[model samples]
Target: MSEFSELRYLCGSLVAVLLASILLTRGWRSKHRHLPGPPPKFLVGNLKDLPTGGHEWDQYAKMSELYGSDVLYMTALGTGLLVINSFEAAHDLLDKRGSVYSDRPRLVMIKELMKWDWNLILMSYGKNFTTYRRVVQQEFQPSTVAELYRPIMATEVIALLDRLLRSPEDLIQHFRLMAGAIIMMVTYGHKVDSVDDKYVALAEAVREYSAQRPGTELVDVFPILKYLPSWFPGAGFQKYAAIGKKLSIQMRSAPFKMIKDRLASGTASPSLASRLLHQSVDTGGIDQDQFAQNTCAVVYSAGADTTLAAMINFILAMTLYPEVQERAQRELDDVVGRDRLPNFSDKGRLPYVSNVVKETLRWKAVAPLGVPHATVSDDVYRDGYVPKGTTVIANISAMLHDPSVYSDPDTFSPDRFSPTDQKSEGEPDPARAAFGFGRRICPGRFFAEDSLWLAVASLLHVFAITNPDGRGGNGVKGIRWSSGLVSLPSPFPYKLEPRFSKAPELVSAAERT
Candidate 1:
């Protein structure tokens, strides 16, 4: 054959192969056309580029801006992902279409290690989820929660004040102790008197388990890795998994065992675990041993760290904005009085104090990205396709900081939530973003709000929180926030001086009562 003819033939053959490959790939793409998302590169999809740890929300926000609010697509490992960044989008999916969007994304390690198949937060939206949620709702029902927890909360607030008076220099530990005590009391009917309580150790273990090296869960992204034997070289998943299992068992079993012992001895205080144990058989609600154990684990895990993180943020907000603190204190003084502590009934009269609580939640949401939700059925959102089983995230951080919604979104301005500060008739409620949206919203929200408000009001009532003076004559400074799934104020130097001589007397009286 002529050289020109041979070249032509070879080129034609190459073109034919390329055409065949394109046709095959096109067919595959057509099958996934219902899902909208950024174009994926070969093999990696978007998982390789997924941001890790605390700042992932920032990256997700940027992607939302680029791809529009209801963007959807697949991850590298063939897991589906849907990012909902706008309030409207989140409302539409997580609320209007909640049936499909209420399920949780699968976490193989968390599931296997913690055995949380039926935990309210981790379980999919089904009979199990419904049952668990109903039980949680009952336990945290407004009347029940207030009745059982108000005294405990009041006592803990007093304890917090006492600690602040004794070591005003250690605000971080005081906040931690107060938060731990309240949650411990609610969860196990036990009070955490000191930071060194065994409950605190259990909490620390959970924190360590959560803060373990980021890439430790290869199985999370690549499910096939889970099938590999633990004996493989560099398989740290097994080690971490073991630790997680041990920690979860300790955390879970301890609370239930306490309840069981109390039930046996007839000394049990009213607790969720106790209620569940007694009701589970009759209701056929959650009778499995592991299921009941997982229920306690869920409440403890959810209750401890996130609640404490919010309380820390509350203190940080007060410290940073003394003016806001002063205003709240004034409102509390007027409504609640110095002789008495704040209570649920005082909520309406203390609108400014309420605003402070709302703004603190808005200023820095404890769960900024909220929790991941998995779609249970194929759906469309804003002309974008959200396939069944897609991992959906409501980027709450973005919604709270949306400039169009909140003027100067970065500023800590509680006044933004003040009813008098409303510029128009149709302004959004600032508290709307704090707890979460729709059915999956934090069930502990009412309890969380009351605890935060009481703490803030009581703290402000007695203390003149200020930045500690520096050696060079500058103020000690505001907190430097730490990065993680939960954003916490890095331990910073601060001075909490008593605002009045009667503060100590007030704390003592409240404790004695």
Candidate 2:
């Protein structure tokens, strides 16, 4: 038979075997089997619902509505997957019982083929995880970030404005570089001198390739399929995995070597890597050095991301709501004056800009379904049995867009979060839902917030962003929110007009030491 036919034959045989096995064991199923979810295929269970190209967060959000909030249950190859759809459920399972629910679900592709099982975010709840979290907390504490990182963020914003003036069409690329440059300096003490720098390329590639998750890949569902020979049918995934493994190695090692060489030559700059090295002890293995390298790698992958999407959305929001943009400019013009750009010192005074940031995060949560977690042992919530080894997901999007929490949740009204606006009925600040819950909360949140605020305040002070094309915003007519780990708006045409006649000169002056 042809390879395609052969692959189909093998798949059919596997399904037959699975269905038979399921029938044989049907009578003695566990108590949790009664939990609610979409009816699974007789044998494959919810595997049919797996989204391949990494937009499955939307599917999970829809499943939440069907399953009726709280805890949800599904089975794949007899392994339980519980999706938490409500705030109470997420806080209860992921926060209260964090000891067991804090662990990440095993991703066979990332763990085996990509060699990223060592990722701090993916590692199980253990001493190493604790060390990573503690170190990140030490480095990114609010006081430390506010004290040290402000100038760095300001300089990058000035540099970004310089780029925005010269090539306004490439504003998106400038945003990416601004974020990447800040991260490179802070994480490794390495200055990114150009937009096409080697480290930038590597980090972007890693993020794109790593988007594939557990349910999205067929290999994750059928563990036995991994053992199948290379010559067997449908073996393309194995080849892809091999390529990913090599890329991951390069991604981790290149910047690490740059930092190590600088340290050896007595030329290292002050940064998280240099600081950690000074504090590291000889742990008698690859671990001590590995710890620094792994932490830097994670920061590199995540640093530019969460805010990149939101900053773009912030610009989009201005185009849609010109009146809001003018109000923010008036705030900036009043506090910062025309002599200098808005600095971090002016943040508290710029409440409107802060509200814009919060709304962007709430409007399109960077991660609709927060990182998948796993249960290490059996537990029960609301009389629902959460079996051991079950994969868990928190439906963050449902909460963010819930009508009850956010009246007119579909509308983009920044006043909803502004305390001074009397029209704004009191609602829980969406900022609570933006970062995350429990142990998995993003460590770089303070740093990211500072960076975003500075960017917004600075940008508002100098520029007027408007969309001549009216379809990009409103009550969500033409707005297209992505379903990736970060839910960013798709590209939309917008104007980048300077508010000041000397915009370029101001940018140049700010860029100078």
Which candidate gets the maximum TM-score versus the true structure? 2
Candidate 2: count the clashes. Answer: 0
Kindly provide the TM-score of model 2 when superposed on the true structure, using C-alpha atoms: 0.91
Please give the lDDT score at residue 184 for candidate 1: 76
Index of the highest-lDDT prediction: 2
User: Listing every candidate in turn, what is its Cα RMSD in Å to the true structure after a full C-alpha superposition?
Assistant: 7.8, 2.8
What clash pairs does model 2 have? none
Q: How many backbone clashes does candidate 1 have?
A: 1
**Candidate 1, residues 59-127: lDDT per residue as tens digits?**
777876776543545554455677766787788778888788888877887776546454577777787
The digit string of per-residue lDDT tens for model 2 on 185-242 reads 8889888867789998998887777665323566665556777766676767787788
Q: After superposition, how far is residue 298 of candidate 2 from its true place, in Å?
A: 0.5
In order, candidate lDDTs are: 0.70, 0.77
Q: Estimate each model's TM-score.
A: 0.87, 0.91
